[model samples]
Target: FMTLLIGSILLPVLVLVGDIVFMFVVVSAALGAVVMTIYGGFETGIEFCHRITMAVPETYWEMIFPSSFEEKSTNWILN
Candidate 1:
């Protein structure tokens, strides 16, 4: 009877401790993921902005002004 009484009290305490530890681990992982995502987004945005600014003139002429390309080529040939 005494053993049963002790077991009953200890079992709940162990279960509670396990639950608390599990919650702590899960929360820590979630926080880490959120922080990484924010930093990753900022890094990607900066990289994309740099690439766009460097490449915009070339891209604009190629895609939006094919006639200009022909004019330049003909001028070069005539020269």
Candidate 2:
């Protein structure tokens, strides 16, 4: 009974946290779109947004794109 009561009280808090995290992700994405548009032009920005919508799972991204530091290091060596 005590466990059930605690769970009930905690459930709403957990839901609120989830909502906040979702909102943050959305806002961050919007900001990224704006920045992409400003720096890369409207077409490039739209392409970026489209890519985000079509993106594969996170694990696949990790495999497909190296970290920026790693990429920079490789480019430096090549140059």
Candidate 3:
């Protein structure tokens, strides 16, 4: 029906807008945390950095660049 059509169209648009808003909120929170940690004048900055780095495992690079040698080859070709 007409309601179904409207729902299908509006649902995706709403979801996309929600995702954008959520991303902005997350970025703002991360920035605020970094600023507070840095200016708080304690070991908070170092601890935050350690926690952030520790959260990412060494295998992250493997997922990002699946083909190590091929990435360099493609970069050289493009440049």
Candidate 4:
């Protein structure tokens, strides 16, 4: 019961944090569109878009793309 309760609370937080990075990606794309519309050039639009993506916090990035070891093992037989 305790494990279930803990998992329930932590899972959503994990999901939400992961989604923030995706949200930034979408935001970056939108920024690019707006920039292109305003500046009338692909290069300037992409330059600003890259800036936003590059600005994502390092910790947030780790959450967005975890290494293989970060994930739990899935080979049931081996486990």
Instruction: Give the candidate number with the greatest TM-score.
Output: 2
lDDT of 4 by residue, 1-79 (tens): 8888769997888899889988986886796669675887777677666555544435755546645562323231311
- Candidate 3 structure quality by residue, lDDT tens digits, 1-79: 8889779988889999999996996686588568868797457666655555444335757546755564434332111
Query: Which candidate tops lDDT?
Result: 2
Could you tell me which residue pairs clash in candidate 3?
A: none
For model 1, residues 1-79, the per-residue Cα lDDT tens digits are 8888778987889899999996986676556555655777867555544543433344546545545654344322111
The TM-score, computed over Cα atoms with residue i paired to residue i, of candidate 1 is: 0.45
Model 4 lDDT at residue 31: 68
Tell me how many residue pairs clash in candidate 4. 0
Better of 3 and 4 by TM-score: 3
lDDT of each: 0.58, 0.69, 0.63, 0.64
Ranking of models by lDDT: 2, 4, 3, 1
On the 0 to 100 scale, the lDDT of residue 2 in model 2 is 77
Worst 10 residues of 1 by lDDT: 70-79
Candidate 1 local lDDT, residue 74: 37
Tell me the spans in candidate 4 whose CA falls farther than 4 Å from its real position: 42-79
Candidate 2 residue-wise lDDT, 2-78, digit = tens: 78876888787899999999799778878888999999999978987776654423455654675666433443221
The total of clashing pairs for model 1 equals 0
